[model samples]
Target: MKKNNINDNDIILEDLQPSHAIHLYEMMQDDRIYTYIPENAPAAVETLKEKYKMFSKGSLRKEEVWLNYAIYLSSEKLYIGTLQATVQLDKRIISIAYILDPKKWGAGYAKKALSIMLQNSKEQFGHFDYYAYIDTRNERSINLVKSLGFKCVEYIENADYFKGSSSNEFVYAKISNK
Candidate 1:
């Protein structure tokens, strides 16, 4: 995968790197960040570094291309969180996901970052459908995706088993112009 570091007026999307592991671990330390996700925060920065290495090698593995970025706020000069796109090249489909520091909540940073990311993705790969799988209980995420024009296409039961229990998830999607 070609690494592209995209800069916007408010935020910069930098390719995920080993240097970001510590910041990512700190940003995701809050349990609230993982409330809706199937995976919990990494136990340590070392683990996160290993995971980042794996993600960097995603394209070589040939299963799917995982484009991961660390969200940096230019104004604050801080690493806020992360954004990822799981691209299925064979199907020409992309699934987007993101996490932001709870401290930055309600600041409209996520929306701005996503807007820039979408524009960049479209430029690099052309028009393709985007999807987001969110837990039904995550009102913020559901609303966020809805605001971006993602319609709920399915309600999946027991879609994920995390923290020792199963949880339901909703599939939200947007079909871009071909």
Candidate 2:
């Protein structure tokens, strides 16, 4: 965890501390959660450590591929999961990705947290569109995004980079600023 200058009350989106790494590592223990993720199973502690190090090093700098945030419940101050956005500055668009603890699934935490992130990004980046790339098989996530106003733009075949030879991808978008 790099030295984070995030204010005590500014939602503390990124630059997570080492103390929070264990909780995040534990959250990755579920195999079902990694079904659509671009990584393999057995998400061990070392994997979490590597991810944290990569985040600390700010390695996703090519075109601002993505900025990851550790989602926390504001009232409980408990770490829920993560949200990320990949900004296409040329297009003035942002695509989002998120995951929550399995225990927290179906509780609307992902929706609420993602909504906050969308609003924050809109404020910071001015008028922009938001998009989501969801695994077609993940009906729950697809439905959740639809509920948030993202319309299905297209169904992509063999679109995922790390799919287990079984899943398809769908691109969805919500044009708020356009």
Candidate 3:
């Protein structure tokens, strides 16, 4: 429930705004980025605009909060991707998700951004469990989260029922000792 803007020396994580749609649309144009995600790459900026607006409004349920951040590179001065956390207030649990422009892959930006986001989440929510649901075939994402200490807890079958396709996914989680 605290303010969501997060910043580090190299990256800026800001609340998703309507104006970010164009940049976000550009980021999503690459088919490689959406290979494991539920939806295909967005075909139009309008779709991104609508999505951003909904994200800005956030969740209405009192105990649930949905936060989305448009990732910006401070050095490059560009909007590159998105990172989000869906928080369960009463349970103090957080589910983290993120996507980066495929062009920016192997640059370690996702790792840095996630580290900052996780630290911020812990500071804001105190002790909480972290979770990430990754497509079973997404080796990159699976390794990324695992490198961050998330362990696979469940194998979900045909769980990604989006865009006319069903794919299996794995639930990765880490319980905070705090």
Candidate 4:
């Protein structure tokens, strides 16, 4: 595995580190990106940095492993987003999560980053089910997962409530063969 970063298609999927918190936290401040996300949870840069430190170290539980990567645009020389994978070791499942700066939306950054992470995930954790839990109102994310060949396996009504929306979620999953 590449310890420094994984490069491809003009983007770099840098292994998540505490140092990335500053830019990421700044980027995430865009209100457009929080439509389906909890607005209150993003405490502060320091808090984010501390959380990232632990994520970089990995999950505290034995049954789960965490993998996070910061999406960097080589040409733009910026950190645009992040991808997170929570691997449930016992269940052989990888619960995927991701977020990109609203300004970078539809620029293909999320797709590329996710693809790279999925590939690297197989290398590090072996074949496992990759699952993305997306809010029903998030059509862009839902479409993105579908384009990546993730089938909607379940519809969870009231999975969460955030941003004045009673959230219904779609559990999307795709199995890894490699």
List candidate 2 stretches off by more than 4 Å.
1-19, 41-43, 59-62, 74-77, 161-164
Quick one: best TM-score, which candidate?
A: 1
For model 4, residues 30-137, the per-residue Cα lDDT tens digits are: 878778876554678998899789879877798988778899998988999888888899999999999898898998889888888888878888899999988888
In candidate 2, what are the lDDT values of residues 1-178, reduced to their tens digit? 1222222352446544445567677776777788876775435767676776675555455555455678776667677787777777678889888878898899887877777777767766778888898888888899889988999988889775665475578999998745
The lDDT values for all models are 0.87, 0.72, 0.87, 0.86
Estimate, for each residue in 41-157, the C-alpha lDDT of model 1 and write its tens digit.
899999999988877666664757888899999888899988999888778788999999999988888888888888898888788899999999999888888888889999999
Which portions of model 4 miss their true places by more than 4 Å? Answer: 1-4, 41-43
lDDT score of residue 125 within candidate 2:
72
Please state every model's RMSD to the true fold in angstroms.
1.4, 3.5, 1.5, 2.0
Clashes in each model (backbone N, CA, C under 3 Å)?
0, 0, 0, 0
Candidate 1 residue runs with Cα over 4 Å from true position: 61-63
Residue pairs clashing, model 3 = none
Name the candidate, 1 or 3, with the larger TM-score value.
1
Residue 15 lDDT (model 1): 92
Q: Which prediction has more favorable TM-score, 1 or 4?
A: 1
Per-model TM against the reference: 0.94, 0.82, 0.93, 0.91
Better of 2 and 4 by TM-score: 4
